[model samples]
Target: MNAPRTPLLEMRGIDKAFGGVPALRQSRLCVGRGEVHALIGQNGAGKSTLIKILTGAYARDAGTIVFDGKGVDFKVPIAAQRAGLSTIYQELNLVPQRSVAENIFLGREPTRFGLIDWRHVEVESARILAGFGMSVDVSRPLRSCNTATQQMTAIARAVSMRAKLVIMDEPTSSLDETEVSTLFGVIRKLKADGVSVVFVSHRLDELYAVCDRITVMRDGQTVAEREMAGFPKLDLVAAMLGKELSVLQGTRRAGPDASMPEVLGVQHLRSGTRVKDASVTVRRGEIVGLGGLLGSGRTELARAVFGADAVDAGQIRIKGKLVKLDEPADAIARGVAFLSEDRKTEGIIADLSIRENLCLVLSPRLARLGIVDNRKQHEITEEFIRKLGIRCAGPDQPIRELSGGNQQKVLLARWLAAGIDLLLLDEPTRGIDVGAKAEILELIRGLADSQGLSVLIIASELEELVAASDRVAVLRDGHTVAELTGDDINESAVMAAMANGTANAAAPAQAGIQEVAHG
Candidate 1:
């Protein structure tokens, strides 16, 4: 019998820090040849830090990296790439001004007689892209392509490198259902070709779908490592969050207060093809969830209510008064704040400091005679940072530098600072870790109970929807199919309603009720 084969990559006792603050301690990982391994943790839990150390983007203060059975310490990203390691970050590193072909073969274009070969670049780039089932013009600027195309282009570039190990950070964040399926196929092909992958994503379903082994990290330490098959989802979440299942449930309200009045009401709402007809009501001090499948108009309905998107035909009532919310400003003036799902593009002003981003909407109010009071701005930022337990250097720190969890807290704090009465949250805890999700959900429940903040939220995770929502309105095919309240607000009931597109006829009337939705 042959001797046991060694892992393709191994890191042991890795330690790293920033500004004297430890980000990783005793973090270790082992990846076998041709294995798809998962690295999961909460934001700021050392996932990114460990990956950076592996890719040579950051130097580890202490540890050993053994790749292909040899110890090595690469000084820079290029050096690591040359050593058969490639990383495709969540943030695209390609140049917007360059064409797809130029990006794919950047720094390594084929040569013909000591000169550049544009023809080879185009043909080879197309061949690589075709492997991902993408058929866009290779000559076009990468910026002109859709988000899915751009992501596929990035993956093509990584595959073309022909590295031994590839690290993908949230690679499916931009892709749709079909595109995600295509990506899975590509990943399978890569496995067949004997390339190992370090897959990182917050989405749990995707993890179970692709990864063979799981490594859970929490608070800069490796907590658990197990085969993905035997590991339960609850156990994985518990390890990543460092909490028990009971404690992880967080604070869920005992349904809405009976005395509380409806703060937000939409009747027969219509917005483009995505939202044909939708109706729901959220009472003060209540969290209402929009439950639906992909492309079921949950996001569109939320946007229309917040006035971020156009309302083709609908009636909106705020506090029992009909209002026309034509624009976001109109909604804001009426005490509505929306947390966008696309955090990078629509939620945060990445270039600004945390102080500026937090107080952006409230700045005008702080201004006296066109001069905003700087002291008041800092005061608000400090207050919310403290209130939300935001871990940061200071309010002046660039918001882009914070982890996903802290950034999300800042966005929620932004609305809290603006004195908004109603909150519309789209995928509030999408990319953050399980611990962050717990914190955010608990915070929302606290707001609804203490501040009487009415909330209408969209969540892709059925467990999250069932746990956080006081009442869940199920929608399918752009129509309000059923509503689940109190005892009926469970995963099975929500999934049934969404799939069947109708209320349960046998149960009590309160068990399932369809909203007043019309086409």
Candidate 2:
């Protein structure tokens, strides 16, 4: 037999922890040279941890990393980059104020004898981007470009380094269909050039389309690793969840009480291509979870219902009364509150104090004849601070100083204190830890039960959604295709509904679902 070929990179028996708490236990990865490898897992499956260790962003507590036929321990990220390893992050790490050419060849530009060659930089950058089907003015500021262009620029920078392996984290999260296709083309080109790629994404279609092999992670461990050819998507999902679908049976619960009044309803809600057509209904004191894959328009539906985005054509009914929502103020006046998925950008004001942020919505009501009512504000802040169990030094502290979990609590308090009838929460428990996620979901559930707050939420975690939601509405290709109830609220059913883009034959969406037919 011939000698075995050495892999491009390998991390065996890796272990890591944060503050003595284990984050990775024997996590491992192996990527072959010139192969496109996919690393996939849920929100907290230690995928990021493993990648960080490989990149030298974090020190591995225990493990041997063999890269390019040498055992190495990278101390800093730059050190890893110099060793023919590069990373392209989801949010992008390039400076928007700089030119595209400057960003692509930021530090290592094509210089001409003790002087910067601006023309060469621009021409070379444009030439490289043309390979990816991107035609743009390279000298222009990066901010002028769209998100997809910015993302591609980041990838171009990685490729220009002549790296042996590239780690792409959620690279397609912001790209459109055409842009994603272009990205796949570039990846293929790299593979043909003998470069390896570690593709990390939650989208199954992209993984199955491009990746040669797969490694599934669950709870800080590598649960499965195999070739991608015949692996079924459903089986992959089950593996990622660490659930044996054949053995586990989901429990059925009673449906919502029909006597309860309808809180919110959307009929044929449409907002551009993001939300083609969506129809959903939420009753008082009920939590309805929105389920869909990436680009499924779940967030768009939530935004349109809350009046944050302009609805091109649709009808919204609150408490059986039709209302026109021209702006968020109109929705707020109608007792509707929205907690955006991006809390740092849309929800919270960095410089504002906790008390100020909490009382921002109720500020107008707390005012008297253009004169502020400071006393009532103070009392309301104190009461909510204690009642919501918000962990902070004091109510006057900056909201940014607290942990992610605490910041979420403050945002929740802001909405709850408004006495809103409907709460449109998009990914409320995101970017927080396991304990905090449980705490936030439990809090929402408690409020729904005790105060009769109707909630419509979108969660990436299927288990959490199944546990917390009274009903789950499945959206496919920007349309509300099915609604799961009682017995069908489990993960498998949700996945099937999302994939097949229809309701189970046994139970379909009540009505108005068949009106907006999908082509």
Q: Which structure among the candidates has the greatest lDDT?
A: 2
What 10-residue stretch in candidate 1 is worst by lDDT?
509-518
- Regions of model 2 farther than 4 Å from truth: 1-6, 96-99, 117-123, 133-149, 247-253, 256-261, 267-277, 293-300, 307-315, 320-328, 338-417, 425-452, 459-464, 467-470, 476-481, 499-519
Candidate 1 lDDT, 1-519, residue by residue in tens: 111145899899999988998899988998889988888886678998998899888999998999988998989999899988988887889998999999989999999999999999999999988876778899999999877778878778878888899899978765656767777777877787899899987655577778888788888999988887666654564565454434323234696667889899999898875677899999998999997755578888988887878988989999889998888999999899999988878888999999999998998999999999999999999999998899999999999999888899999999999999999999999889999999999899889888989999898777788889999998875788798887777665665565345544223322222221122
What lDDT score is found at residue 204 in candidate 2? Answer: 66
Candidate 2's TM-score:
0.76
TM-score to true structure, per model = 0.65, 0.76
What CA RMSD would you report for each candidate?
Answer: 8.9, 6.2
Cα RMSD for predicted model 1: 8.9
| lDDT (10s digit) by residue, model 2, range 292-320 | 86567888888787778889888999889
